[model samples]
Target: MNDPAIAVDGLTKQFRGGTRALDGLSLRVSRGGIYALLGPNGAGKTTLIRILATLLRPDGGTALVAGHDVVAEAGRVRQLIGLAGQFAAVDDHLTGRENITMIGRLYGLTRRAATSRAAEILTRIGLDTAADRQVKTYSGGMRRRIDLAASLIGRPQVLFLDEPTTGVDPASRHDLWSLVRDLAADGTTVLLTTQYLDEADQLADRIAVIDHGRLLTEGTATELKDRTGAAVVELDLPPHQLDAAMTALQPLAPRRDRDRILLPAPDGPLTLRHAMGLLDQADLTPTDIALHGPTLDDVFLALTRHNTSRSARSTA
Candidate 1:
């Protein structure tokens, strides 16, 4: 295949003190698409992102972003990409407009051009009215919007978002997703790192799961879920009979909570019916029961668990 918007081959990072932050991680993100790098904390997702952003050097392998080698063409790579890290990058002392303008100037835009571009970007991000407001006074969502605008000041071809919506409200998070979709639609490739599986499900055209500095798997949401081959069944048992309920649903039980039992139901409708019938036979009626397709959360848990077991044995 042609070179992807972002490509890495055996990229690795070994920090001082022998900390292996990245272990031969490989990934490919198609052009004009949104690729999500997802993993729990300490999984090297951030480290990989730092490497891609050219903030950290890798000890082995290579990373080419937007067809520019991250090491050999670091400056060119910087010109082609924008990064909005976990913390809002807006300076509290500066107004939203000033923040954008400052970044535009830093990118070498003329003063007049930077001002104009900053105005346009503020308007685009729905912050024109608050453009003159100090970032310290802006709400979390507003600051985030301003931060996003700053990243776009140079009109970079690729954008990197690291947990962009970690602390935003639900409504704001949804709004950000819409903005990201719009950017991708406009042909800007986005590589986002997030711990939220739902965020990946909603925004990612494809996802790469990383754990313990290694790439566990990468595929479209449906593709990854399909690999699991396990349908999820959620059942709510009567509060008092929850303990006994697990016994009756033993065949379908993979996990149990206070009043819910989770299990695999690969056969879908037929399997669900059989499970319900079995519960009925035991004279236990569920208040709620639902069947769901495989989710990214399931895939992450399954793959990471398997990897963990293998890693432990190898160490032994």
Candidate 2:
């Protein structure tokens, strides 16, 4: 489709206690790939998700899903989107198949169709053998997968995943990532909200970094990383010399990570030489030093330094 799958314009939502969950936030998500809303806790990531999913109303502005207005055409939007929240919404007492089938039926599918869809999705999500098993018997990873399966029962065009891999182990998180990639490859547009830096870096085709209910930046992972600089200089100095070195390199805006001090080398080699000069001025001898490409962690550190987070009354 030529139009974006999801669109928001000057969205504003305030709570009863005068807290701003969303402050004139606007975003455009294209169809058929993963678009991530990246931020720390209470950054309004969940608030945006809830508004786009039509679970909550936006106090101002407008939104559209698959080209339909979220407020005026909520019913139409609901028909085209599927949502999987932070926690698994499956019944412990029910079998995985039953849970999925029930959701399909609620979407207005006939018993036979719902059953068939459940079976198809169960296998698609690698839960076929566990289909008949009670959800209570499933592992944390398996339960998350089952909840995802239920969301897919209707084969929605646009899927909303709110922190999909919040607590899954590394192995399960990897599996979920692969599944999400495959779904996008098959033409499902996924709008993911997450606080996990690696999750957004590894999965999103593009990322929107939001803080305090507003956009800080938006781009491909590499593009966002480049915002920090072309490269980063990491220095390992003698433990005793750290204090003097910090004061000496104040102009570089250095931040310490464990035993290393990180500085953005925007001019690459030139900035690197400057860092060494600054250290030399303080008579500080470094144990080691190197320059490397910017990472999401580096980008995040740069952003948070200038844009601090504030507490929201309630959004999630």
The lDDT leader among the candidates is: 2
Every model's TM-score: 0.90, 0.89
* Model 1 regions more than 4 Å off: 243-253, 256-259, 269-284, 313-316
Across 56-145, the per-residue lDDT of candidate 2 in tens digits comes to: 999999999999998898999988888896745689999999999998898899999999999999998999999999999999899889
Error of 1 at 148 (Å): 1.1
Summarize candidate 1's per-residue lDDT along 1-316 as a digit string, tens digits: 4669998999888877767778888888989978998887788888888888898889999999989999999999999998886646678998888888988888899999999999998888889999998899988887778878988987878999888888788898998999889899999999998878999998999999988789888999999999998888888877887877778878865577566887778888888898888888888988998999888888998888778877664322
Identify the leading candidate in terms of TM-score: 1
- In terms of TM-score, how similar is model 1 to the real structure? 0.90
User: Any runs in candidate 2 off by more than 4 Å, and if so which?
Assistant: 237-248, 277-288, 309-316
lDDT of 1 at 195: 77
lDDT of each: 0.86, 0.88
Clashes per candidate (backbone, < 3 Å): 0, 0
lDDT of 1 at 166: 81
